[model samples]
Target: MAKIAFILLCHKDPDAVINQAQSLTAVGDCMSIHFDARAPRAQFDTIRDALKTNPNVTFATRRVKCGWGEWSLVQATLHALHAAVAQFPDATHFYMLSGDCMAIKPAQYVHDFLDRRDVDHIESFDYLTSDWIKTGWREERLVYRHWFNERTQKKRFYAMFELQKRLGLTRAIPGDITVMIGSQWWCLRRQTVESILEFRKQRPDVMRFFRTTWIPDETFFQTLVRHLVPERDIDSRTLTFLMFTDYGMPVTFHNDHYDLLLSQDFLFARKISAEAHDLRRRLGVLYACEGARFRISNEGRSLFTFLTGKGRTGHRFAPRFWETESTLGRERDLLIVLCRKWHVARRLVDCIRTSTGLPCIGYLFNDESCALPDLGGIQDSMDKRHRHRRALLRMLYEHYDSDRLLICLDPSNLDLIEDFCRDRSVTRLLEIDCDFSDRDLIEHAMRVGLAGDGTPPETLARLLPTIRNDMALETDTLRDRNFAHHSRLREADPPARNARAIAAFLDCSEPIAGALATTDQLFAE
Candidate 1:
């Protein structure tokens, strides 16, 4: 196994970044560089002073602009690669890293395992479905599209949708591409590094697109390599790999799950706020023989199953239809924010209790649970069932929070709720809104809680008067309260409807991904 190295590339110094970097440098030799010219010169000044005693640290040439539309990232990657090679020429592979990442495993164990991969590039990855490519998105790319001139911006919906639909029917299209690259950090062998560098020297187009294109470095590298060597043995599934023992086509994030892949796994270990200090803490542990393996909790997986189940962010499928209804012909918008976690359900339960004045039935169903029979008296919620004879007792519970959820109900479901609320006095109001009249839906009610894990409650609080005035809520008691603000349903966020994009993405050639000794246009027309 080659000695693992730390290639810390950063732009600015946040309060805890350097402290974080110091933590990550434990597993191997460390090289630190800043894209100094494009950012404030004093960005990581405190970091430099702190590291003055560390003789092995290296810095990039000052005044270099690591712009979005240029080969600056490649430049930075190469800079670290070239420098690391000089310091340790005999090392077999180098793990490219970012300042924000923390190694979940011990350093020696990580290096030893990383060094053992059969392929040159050990970035864990799988092929992307047509959906991801057409609808491929993240915060950064969204920012890029916003910078588009008016024409290009509109061209996206039309062009992307058309291409995506076409791609689905003809999945073997030659020049078009698919496959999401793993993140910027990959356990790449020295050979892959040389190949990418050689290509940089030979193909300015690749470099130009990387810089000028708003594509993040993660997708850019894999795309470039795939176009170069479509048949290569590259692991498309990078960050969360070890759990997957299968090497099948159409690789997905779900292949090797740690029971429930909670939001914590998705967020990786570092917070956007404390990311700076993670490096040092991680590095210290790496030196102590811990590298980068993250321990996952079971609760996370259960929640993940819930969130990703509907093919939304993190839902895994549940066997039966779990209480959902639809307004098939209603020209209304239903903006649903759901996750597979019990906490999300619990929170929603609370909201429902406060808003709807009706008592609720909280049923905890087992996978073996059968459907409930419908009786004539209760109301229905979308499509979920409630009233039954044999399995009735096991499926019903008193929900203190059901009324606030505000769903149209069937008679059986209503009766179920009434039955479950034992001894408690409950009042049933038969009022319902068919034309979107009730504006206090949960989506509009919770904007304050959604605004940036932030603490601007006063700023949010001040807007209450205007909101109350608009709603025509007459009472003085309602003035300062955080009430539901109904939003007009617009076309569901457009990029989400990537009709053209999805088609184009689906039809692209599969990655000849794997150990790349010969990726010279293997899938060319």
Candidate 2:
């Protein structure tokens, strides 16, 4: 018996909007669309004509010229809500969405899910205690008057804001309202929507106050709903699954994210690309289906959190060809293995992996093959670029979730080697002296294309000394190769000797004999 009246604020992509309108109306739901006044008149006409025959669809009479972070956005939503309420008397709930939002679940599933719960689904958090807003003005946004649109009239906006600040001009919220902040997208029960509109009519002064507030759209309805509705009747979370970047920009969904979107428990997703025709078509088919349960999976959330949250290691300096600065932050429990020979590095990594059960990666900076074999075919998927390499390292650090990560690097990778040595995160720097003659080092360098002429050998000659100097100045734990440890690592049963040395370096409490036994099994591989 429950029905949803979807209010959409559209700016562009009339065709996509039309598709969404038709799909929602097909299930007996009503739709009210408010196309931005700034958009081309032709686009509005096209959408209106396409949905003219559908009795469930209506358009707001007043088209507000909406701008980012302006009061007009809320005005547009209100215009559409008024129209929807007047036209669809039987509608039980109001769901707010945008032109790019699409139903990730079936329409029937959404209706049933909402009908089962009487609580309104919207993200409302106490602005003072919450860290929701990533950047820009927070408490000041409400305390000061914002007269100009921040996007279009940036200079006037800031100038007026600063002028007000200097003049000590401040405003206080009405005593009756408790300010809350959240995402602009929301779903409200019909009663709650009517209460909000009724409050707007009764409190014109409060509405005017919000008009002068910055980014009022995010705060206006959120503050009102909390003030009008009982705390028990509200669920402080959005039904729409929206993600933002570290810089507070929405992450746009593309065709490849179709499966990920389906895995979320949220009924809808926003900011979908208009050109993702395949994603739209597939989701449209799924939306029209009946009796289909929402598929819940954490893979999407896990991947998103890894990419957006934990993956950002806060490395101050990105790797650049001409830049010599090291990555800024200290990586805890990280070990850098610098060696000239690939086989020797491989053996050392294998010995450590077997002995300590630690995660070890080989040739992380190598352009030839996948550095992370555990990820399976990731190297082929992305281009061999500095950014991609940095991403890979971030993923490796996050994926292992261990106390220690062992990374092997060829000494010829001077840029990466220098950066790693200077990085505070690297706890241990192990330089293995394989005792290769100058001719051998030169030959190996030439094979790897590092020997462009005379430059490489000179660079290679200074590599160890420079690293030693950096370690002495920057770090407390630097293990240089002495004759005893080198001889042990190069012995006939080198894996056992290598394991003992590594165990000692790491200060492992385990018996050396046990580690030696494990090293034999590793060599059998």
> What is the lDDT of every predicted structure here?
0.39, 0.73
Query: CA RMSD for every model?
Result: 21.3, 14.7
- TM-score of candidate 1 against the unseen true structure: 0.44
Which residues of candidate 2, in runs, are more than 4 Å off? Answer: 305-511, 514-525
For candidate 1, the 10 contiguous residues with the lowest summed lDDT are: 508-517
* lDDT, candidate 1, 72-116, per-residue tens: 565666677666666656556666555444444455655565655
Where model 1 places Cα greater than 4 Å from the true spot, the runs are: 14-21, 43-55, 61-63, 66-75, 120-129, 133-182, 227-232, 240-268, 275-525
Instruction: Please give the lDDT score at residue 481 for candidate 1.
Output: 29
- Residue-level lDDT of model 2, residues 123-146, one tens digit each, is 889877888876667878988999
Q: Which candidate leads in lDDT?
A: 2
Cα lDDT for residue 209, candidate 2? 93
Worst 10 residues of 2 by lDDT: 478-487
